[model samples]
Target: MSVSSVDDRQRAARLLLRHPLIRSTDEERYRLVRRYSSDLEEWFEINTGWAMHADSEVVRLEREPATVADPTHPFATRRGGAVLSRRRYVLLMLGLSVLERSDSQVALGRLAEQVIAAGTAPEFAAAGFSFDLSTREERSDLVAAVQLLLEWGVLVRVAGDEQDFVHKTGDALYDVSRRVLSQLLVTRRGPSTISAQTLDDRMVAMRDRGAAPTTELRNLRLRHTLTRRLIDDPVLYFADLDDEESAYLRSQRAALCRRITEFTGLVAEIRREGIAMVDLDDDLSDVRMPEKGTEGHVTLLVAEFLARSGVAEHFVASLVAHVRSIAPDFAKYWRASALEADAAADLVATSLGRLSALRLITRTGDIVRVLPALARFALAEPTILGGRKP
Candidate 1:
């Protein structure tokens, strides 16, 4: 292939890995995805076991995780950026189901009623879900779920504002995109076919469809799992893998990392503890570090402290106190609200959330263990030999 073709293919692959969905509304990206659809499909299928579908209207990449155990990355509402709680997730699913049977154009109030009906069904009630939208908080949760769908392009706002509906002043209208809606579920098998009694079992069954007994199949599974984790996760820790997976990774690390790097333009940072596919442009990740904002500043400071402390673990409450003690130094740079005594908890939580998401730390209950990756953030002590501080 020519140099330009190689660059274009890498760009297209990176776009799909980052966004995963490009609608016709995103004309340029959708066209790029369509142009390289065949190459992208073969590459992803063979390397990551991910399936990509590109059509005139939309391009969707169906991604299945190697494991469903991680909870660091949660679906957050765009409004306040709060992670979706269990209740909100349930509401989101209910709303999606309602939209599946909805007309092309759906009114906010009509959809709300349908979601409420489905949410409050005897089956759902048995699971302790109750929704009448009688309270403002409940209405806000519904709006958050709808807003998530709107962000995903599954619903297009037609005329009204969702906040007006939240306040009970007016309702909104939306044009549903069934094509995009159908692409929401990415499991290998339909969930209804699982017949598993527990959620964990069902999840396993859904992802583990077409399992066969063979050494080759086992090796293929191991390769796909390792590749998927390395590409999708911020860091792939050796400790997180089983013996077989760890062994396979040890034997094929160079080849696997090279293929991923060539395709996505990511540089692999391999350490003894784990490996991280470092994105040079920093555009591939949803969670960014050292960002510009109060939360970002606090997270950076907290990371520096943890990195320098050299302690393997610390209680979260102790970190809250540490933040409180250092709040005065950052009061001028940080938001006024973050300086309050009560704000230390939130600051600490946000900082730890970012650090944890980056795989620099792992939290077990109240204790946070600093990972080896966090050591890079440590700073050297100032030397008096320097004439003056810059």
Candidate 2:
């Protein structure tokens, strides 16, 4: 048979297979056979070696199930299967490095230098950055990577010509949301649990207390203050702090300001910007006023006065006379007269404890230092300002 005839027969066979009934009246059977004659002929030619009966062949084809492609199979169209390439990983690391070093602008040459210093191979750094190249292909990859980071809102490139492109001020620095590089640097890790003796043994030979040590107590005190300052400043950069204590300092972040004026302004600014204050007293009217004769109330009142005055040590007689004059009701309530020596001593001890608990004053061997928070509070409160609480 001709190739075209064979193709027509195959098409007829498909149509015949789609039909239901096989047996019928002689006339009906004749019509059906005539209609599917090309189909039967095609089936016969294709299955010639099988020598199967027409009914059996029809049953076999009908019983067979259709083959289907699996839905779960890995296809090129599926998402989340693409792995990050090595070059992309390196670029990400470089971007992080740039963020760690600078907040404002970072030049391509400088970034390349940092990457090289960070132990990336020289060739990779050289290929990644160009000081002179202005062509699209040469610069496209780096620019694209930076643009991707900018789109992610983790970086921003300053507006300029291609050759003059630099990271924007405060753009190179990012709040690294994840601890991706914690293990990469030793300083990024937490404080070691090693004992002082072990640390000394590892660093230098054992020395007597009389021996001149590398770290003196005064130096340690200075280091502690400096480290504390870094932790307390939100805008402080890691580069601004000493590397040896950076991790420790980074861990101990308190409320950003130590001074009352700074704290109040910051709080007021936050409130003005519609930021809700956390852990604040909601009802100003509900503030408990100190009562007379109550040891706790009298102690708090005395401490508040001394803290307000910014005086550490007051003469016992002077403090008693002052308290008696200011809080005459409290003096009248006192079972022991304000002039009594025992009453004066009791007042002082109670006041000291109350003030220390409030962190208003620090007592070291009878000397007290006023905390800045308390000093600010004194300035704000009417009672401390020599006026009655409204």
Candidate 3:
């Protein structure tokens, strides 16, 4: 059978084993090696450690180590296994909101204002009192919060002299990093308290319905909600975030965006088309593969072009031309194939069939359209790369 015809379950298992964590687990590693020994050699490099164990003895484990990290590397840390305190998690959520809402050069005072608005203002107003946090202790709390944010790299202090300090304006606004917020907001809630049997039942139910796994969807939703929340909330200011924390938060946000996009693309493909083997094509060979899972990417590209062109489809060609001129990075991703250019008139006809299957996007002929849900993914928040509603 062709590589494209490989069983998806087998493929997924192979993919799972590619992870360092999974490979470290003797049972899972051996099971994969046993069932697909030939495929395994092509897909992975087995270590001497794995060579010593018999394949049959490996399948008894209830859990497997994560595959994303290198087990043999001394410095390689396990992914998604670290425990975070509730307080830190709360701060992370708040920080994400701040990053999402504020733009570069946001004032510290503004962040304090938002925090007070969200947490304290209503109580004070109801008591018929003019509440002011001008005291040292109150100011310290604000400082502490901002410092935390800064340390996370979500916010940066504006530079100035000593006079900038004495003015005590506390106006030290921060430049919010949307990427940082996006990452923090997507922090996962651990496995449910549900029993293992119940979980297995749910997985079985999903399989019966020919549905993509529910666990995958749940994780996607969690990330999506976080991204949406960040875009909707007020930004955390520099004074609220310290240097170290600010950097950390920024890295997280970047990672989140990259993962979200990848996951979105992968899930959309799976939902629209059943599992199929993916052989990364580097030679640009002309292969007759089934159309699936590419609609969202295409729609996004077209919609972005249309939106920038004032929502008129008539100017699509001109818009495409303009994108080529002004946004080369975007152009590289959206460029049509040589065959597409050769069959210009037929391109739309060919693409429509594939675009329709994903359901995440809508298209009328060549005029790309996006559904409300898909549109949310494309929304641009000044704070986030693609904005979402709260």
Cα RMSD, model 1: 2.2
lDDT of 2 by residue, 303-341 (tens): 667767866565555655555565556655666565464
Residues 110-197, model 3: lDDT tens digits: 6656655554545445645332356654555455556656654566666532223224653575666544433332112222332335
Q: Poorest 10 consecutive residues of model 2 by lDDT?
A: 63-72
CA lDDT of each prediction against the hidden true structure: 0.88, 0.41, 0.38
TM-score of each: 0.93, 0.25, 0.25
Give me the candidate number with maximum TM-score.
1
Local lDDT at 114 for model 2: 62
Please identify which of the two predictions, 1 or 3, would achieve the higher TM-score against the true structure.
1
TM-score of 2: 0.25
Candidate number with greatest lDDT:
1
Better of 1 and 2 by lDDT: 1
RMSD of 3: 25.1
Candidate 1 structure quality by residue, lDDT tens digits, 1-390: 898988999999988887788899998898888888999999889887889887767899987776788778887765666888888899889889999999999998999899988876787778887888889999998898898889889999999999999999999999999999998899978887878888899888888757658998888878888999888888998998889999999999999999989888999999999999999989887789989999998899889989999899899999999999999987889889998879999988988988988899999889999998999999888667858768
